[model samples]
Target: MKTRAITGFFFVVVMLGSFFAGAAVYSIFFGLLAIVCLQEFYGLLKKSGSSPNVATGLINGAYTYAAFAALFHWDVYPEAQTIHKLVFLLVPAMLAVFVQELYRNTDKPFQNIAYTFLGIIFTIVPFSFFHALGFVTNTGFSAHIPMGFLLMLWANDTGAYLVGRQFGRAKLFERHSPKKTWEGFIGGIIISAIAGYVLSIYFKELEWKQWVSMAIIISVIGTLGDLVESMFKRSINVKDSGGILPGHGGLLDRFDGLLLAAPMVFTYLYFIFN
Candidate 1:
């Protein structure tokens, strides 16, 4: 517990600092995070006997994040057509992965292609939505959108852990996660809603209702994201995703909820504001 607390404190400081620092810090922070997560994911696949092309996948994952950054944030690619041109650079880059896999002539060549691309699709695509949250209004940047998501997500996690430990009786999903409880899930939603209410007071980009809605989405969908990652680890017969964070598992373990929830929240904001 002491190790977890210590590691978690620094983790929160760095994350919050990245948010307050500005867009450049935020981009570089998540960009490197995506790369590390993709590497960790591919590392898991390699341990599972699926030799994914780690280097090529990392390149594509970085490229994909770059493409999303260009599409959503960069002013140089202003037009819709320009966005396509900027983003399509990934197509050839992905194809290069396939060609390189063929030349390697390793066993299960197609499986390598599939898992390699899967790592990028799983890790990079979802993180790219962070860029969308900033420019939801078609102009200017608001860290609140992305940061709000993180705040609510943290609230849900803390709530669930505390509540679930105390009164958790029924298993939420015993197969993938034996400790998750429906009671804890409910508590997480309530806590996230309260966090949203508080956030609405400080960040008035949206109404209190909108922020609370985001909390519900995070509590529900983000829990699923955690389960999905647990399922991945269970399938691979591993305990933690990596040891980069000491007590906190790995990049993938820490950011699993964000991986799935960011895109949904961004889509919700896009429809709401656009």
Candidate 2:
């Protein structure tokens, strides 16, 4: 518990720092995070006897993330226009994996290629949407939505963990996650709503109702995201994704909720802002 708490503290600090620092730091930090998570995911696949083209996949992942980052900054930075043009090359870069696989002479060439791209789709695409969330509005980069999103997510996680441990009786999903309970799920929503109410007092970007709505979205959908990731790990018969974090499992374990929830929250904010 001590290790987990200490690691969680630093994780929150670095995450909040990334948000407050500026767009460059935020972009770079998450860009690297996406790459690292992608690598971890590919590593998991390889352990399952599936050969993923790690080199091509990482290069394409990096290129894809950089392109998306540049596109997100198109409004604020002029040079972003040039960097944004790199997005057009994304298709060719992805296809290069297929060509590279052909020479490997492996029988499962398509399977290899599929998993290679799957890594990018599973990891990079959501992160790209997350990166876009920081630039959702035309006015400028605002951390209110993204930061609030994290606050509510953390709130739900805390609430569920505490409440589920105490009052949880009915299992939420016994197959993927046995500890989760319907009671905990409801508890998470309530606590996250309270967190939203508090956030409205400080961040005036969204109305209180909107804030609470986002909280519900995060609580419900983020839980689903957690379940999905759990399912993935269970399929592979692994206890944790990796041991990168001492108490925490891996990058994927830490950010699993964000994987699915980021895109949904970004869509919500995009419509609200635009």
Measured by lDDT, the strongest candidate is 2
Per-residue lDDT tens digits for candidate 2, residues 166-192, read 999999999999999999999999999
By summed lDDT, the worst window of 10 consecutive residues in model 1 runs over: 72-81
Clashing pairs in 1: none
User: What's the lDDT for all of these models?
Assistant: 0.88, 0.90
Off by over 4 Å in 2: none
TM-score of 2: 0.97
Clashing pairs in 2: none
Tell me the RMSD of model 2 versus the true structure.
1.2
Best by TM-score: 2
